[model samples]
Target: MKLVDVGGRTMAYHRAGAGPALVFLHGGWSDGRAWGPQLAGLSDGFDVIAWDAPGCGGSDDPPREMTMADYADAVAALVAELGVEAAHLCGISWGGGLALAVWQHHPELVRSLILVGAYAGWKGSLPPEEVEARVRRLLAEAERPPAEWMDAYLPTFFAGAPPAGSLELVRSMMLDSRPGGLVPMLTAFADADLNAVLPTIAVPTLLLWGEHDDRSPVGTVAQALRSAIPAAELVVLPGVGHEVNLEAPEAFTTEVRRFLQAAGATLIRVSRATCALCGQQAASEDVPLTWMTSVEDGRKRLYCDRCARENVRSIEGKLDPVYW
Candidate 1:
């Protein structure tokens, strides 16, 4: 863990490897340590940094009145302090909202964006009633013992039972979350509405989602994001849930790497086409395979027209076509 003072607030972060900078911003309930897998896995290829935002992990509690813009400026200060010219910001959930805030406030510092189980903002993606309910729940949960609430709440973040130790790791982080920090950190997002900011994004943006994400359901939230961000690509991890990074770390990391590489490429040229779901080959030169760029590897994925139409809803929902 590294410590830096940005505007009198001591922000903490973890860094590893060396290459183009990749910064990870965790969700409301999590701190920088939640990105352990990403920091370690992507270290060999990039300079990965994960920060514990104000009120989370080793960072100090923020003022009750702290705004998302304040958080964005804090991120910019940290990046400037680290001497990085630009970076790819990858954020999940509330962190995703912060990433949008950063892009809005500090566009020049961002090279690209990767948002997982993300939202434009609570107001931008969720219905007004749902947003109120979620904020109310967060307020209630902030005062309850971590164990009592997490037992029932945490399951909603995963597709099924979490792998052994996964739940424990998240539980420990939630346990460490202070109400002083958590309340402010969460409420800031509750009041945010970045719908206007979405259309202004000029950087390469990738939207990753868990097919069964109950909190930020792919069909509603992810699609709203995709339709708003011009040319943003969406990839749905099958059988995954809201905690896309934790539930499918390898896939999450791979997709990030692939998106970064593609974003940096001078030109995109396809050599062959095959259905990512059915493994069927495209038969003719004129046949167009529906594009699905972020598969496990670097190959460009395309679904046959037959498969595409049959599973159009799933594809639009960004689910693994296999499920269709």
Candidate 2:
């Protein structure tokens, strides 16, 4: 365990390995230890750092009024204190939102981003009311036989059959978590909205989603993210849940390793015609250009034809015939 003074708070973190820094941010109802499986495997290849967020595990409790931006700032401060110029950032669930916030506000410090079961906001698609209801139910059931109760809630987080011991692990973590810490974290999550900042993230991004994640459903949130962020890759894992890293460590590590390796490469081949406007390779001619945007001065600033036409129509009071 290591402690760093971040904004007057004693933040607790654990580090291993010796190469490029890789920071792991755990989701709600979980602490940094949730990333144990991933750290165990990835630490050997990279410098893996996992920390307990404010009020969780070994960290000091932050005020209940703390916002997502505050959490992101804390992470940025930690990176600076460690003298790491850049690092790979990975987060799950609520932590995923924090990771996105960090990337949005501190792109220069991020080498790449990996988000699992993340959401843009609670407004669109998954309404706050629905998420609140589900979270309430799960929290209420925490005192009961966690394994059995969690089995019912598991479907929302995962896709196919739950992996052996998956429920048990979740149950243990839930039981061990500090309920006092969870309250404000959940409140901060309810207030998060990363949509406005998504496009500002310039680092390579990989979104890992469970095929049947109810908390942050795959189709709407994942698709929206893929469309919003340029050069972002979405990987939907079959038969997995909200905790893909725990449910399928092998699969999760494989995808992460591949993305990191690709990110480190110097020469990337992108189509001239397609890459001219959007810096990504066009997989097929039929690929939709709605989300494809142009990068300007190292920052992706190009808007798709649809967005351009919409802007013109909004201002000119008429649709452009050429765009149509």
Q: Name the top lDDT candidate.
A: 1
RMSD of candidate 1 to the truth, in angstroms, is: 12.4
Tens-place lDDT digits, model 1, residues 110-170: 7789999988878778899998998898888877888778777787888887667778889
Over the stretch 1-324, how does candidate 2's per-residue lDDT look in tens digits?
788888787888888888889999998767877787777889878999988888887788888687778788788888888878679999998888888878766655677789888876454336777768856864675456544554465556556555677666666766656655676677677767788666555556899988767677787888988887766789988877788898888899999888888877522221222322434534554333332222333322323454545432222232111110
Lowest summed lDDT over 10 consecutive residues: which window, candidate 1?
315-324
- In candidate 1, stretches whose alpha carbon ends up further than 4 angstroms from where it belongs are 266-324
How does model 1 fare in lDDT? 0.81
Under the 3 Å rule for N, CA and C atoms, how many clashes does model 1 have?
0
lDDT of 1 at 322: 17
